[model samples]
Target: MAAEQAPSSNDVRTWERIDFHAHLLPDFYQRALTETGEAGPDGMSAAPGWNVQDALSMMDRTGIRFAVLSLSSPGVHFGDDAAARRLARRINEFGAALVTEQPDRFAMLATLPLPDVDGAVAELEYALDVLHLDGVAIETNARGLYPGDDAMRPVFEALEARSALLFLHPTSPPNHGSVSFGRPRPILEFPLETTRAVIDLVLAGTLRRSPRVRVLVPHGGGALAVLADRVATLAPAQMDLGDVDVIAELGALYYDVAGMPVPRQLPALLQLASKDRLLYGSDWPFTPIPIIEAMAAAIGSTDLLTDADREHIGWRNAVTLLPRLAALAH
Candidate 1:
């Protein structure tokens, strides 16, 4: 792989943003979706066609310097733990190889075979230590089990030990009837599910127990900004929170402005967390390039966030989270 030339001062006008929530659809992952015969498992009408070249073109056009890749919805395991394990390893190897080649353009959050506790743990160990991935991307709920479930404690413990970066991606909610009331899932259910999972993690004391784990949540933390007060009020009484400050903990975690970052979403997120807590994301492949470009334009036009705020969310905060990006920032 050829080294990307350091951007000229004028080139900064292009994609200087660091995308924390981009995805990679490995051929095997696409095969899984095809084999299942599911039409847009993420609630879209059908799966979007994706390839490395397409992603690169979109990134270059939109001013994204580096995109941290993760597998999107329906994650690694599709009701088969063993198959998921193999797929996870293959995906990790593929992503690691890409990072090795680009080093500047891409980094990856390893996909683990979750809801398969032992396999997840083993994969996490190898992906982080051996493959040298930046971190792991996890579903809000894994195979009908939320990340906060006591069953996944060992995995959380391992993440805490490594102080790993955990990027939480929302999944299709199980039993999606009412939420699906002829409405698109990403329009309603996706953000709502992310809210539910984060609530579980907070109320279940998972965040409290795993203090060292730096979490990165997408879609500006979904519904968290809207529901912050409710969870803040109820969590302490319902859970054994000890001395932990619920609001502070939530504020400390990272959120990415991947979807429609303006209007109500960004403002609400700002109220919940400091500006530094926010990161930029494009949601490429799944999100059309036009929408991503629109998001960038919106951010540029917005009066709510200052120049410093834009800089932080664009890539500064992300570089702070993953230092290797700093070297590539030029």
Candidate 2:
């Protein structure tokens, strides 16, 4: 196969995109999920299937120059600490192999066994130092504990120490049974879950303390653009924020335009987050390929963004955050 030619300035559809929110559901990881009775996670009927060829084809069709793959929601931890540790190693190794095989087309974020701080820290070390994966991807909440919880401090500290790029994907909130109303959790609860995690991180001063860890929030920050002011005004009165500016903290983070971010979500996000921090994301395999194509088209044609802004979102901003992409390109 011939390498794709670089797009000319006028070629809107052929913009080389770097997808920051793509997922990989390997058979081994799926088997782990199934054994734990999470075959249908967060109310979905079954986990989406994935393979390298199909992913490569989709990337070629959609003009994606590179993708950062991750393990999606319900993560590796399923109650037992030892099982979670083993599963995390398996997942990271799988991703590292993929990246090694196709360094130009793919990069991977390592998975960690969260809620078990010791295991998570150890895995983080091995993943970064040994496997040499790009960074870490963590669920919004791990076994009912949000990222800001005191127990997760060590994990955050380790990530900060390494100056890691952290990708935040929302999982089913701990109280899904009562709030989800029996619907698939991704439809309604996922966005709210992302919002909840961000608020918790800000309120608990986690973001303030972990200044070096570059964080990417998925789904255009999950209703954060609309709700940020409300949280800013109301949270200080209720919680001891200790001089943390809610809006500032929210604005400082990076965000990906995955899962229908244009028209409403992108504009809302722009009001809060800087344009330079925005990146493209396909949320593929889980989101069907047809929808991914349509969303890419929408991003290309949307009048909301200038050509420069579109180029930035497509890949420039991502290269800034993940310098490995730039290094690989050379």
Best by lDDT: 2
My TM-score estimates for the predictions, one after another, are 0.93, 0.95
Q: Flag regions of model 2 displaced more than 4 Å.
A: 1-12, 327-330
Q: lDDT score, residue 209, model 2?
A: 90
Candidate 1 lDDT over 99-204, as tens digits, reads 9988888999999999899999999999999999999999988878889999989999999999999999998788876568866677778888888898788778
lDDT of each structure?
0.86, 0.90
Q: Model 2's lDDT to the true fold?
A: 0.90
Candidate 2 per-residue C-alpha lDDT over 187-213 given as tens digits, one digit per residue, 9 for 90 to 100: 989999999999989998899999999
Task: Give lDDT: candidate 1, residue 59.
Answer: 81
Please give the lDDT score at residue 105 for candidate 1.
89
In terms of TM-score, the best-performing candidate is 2
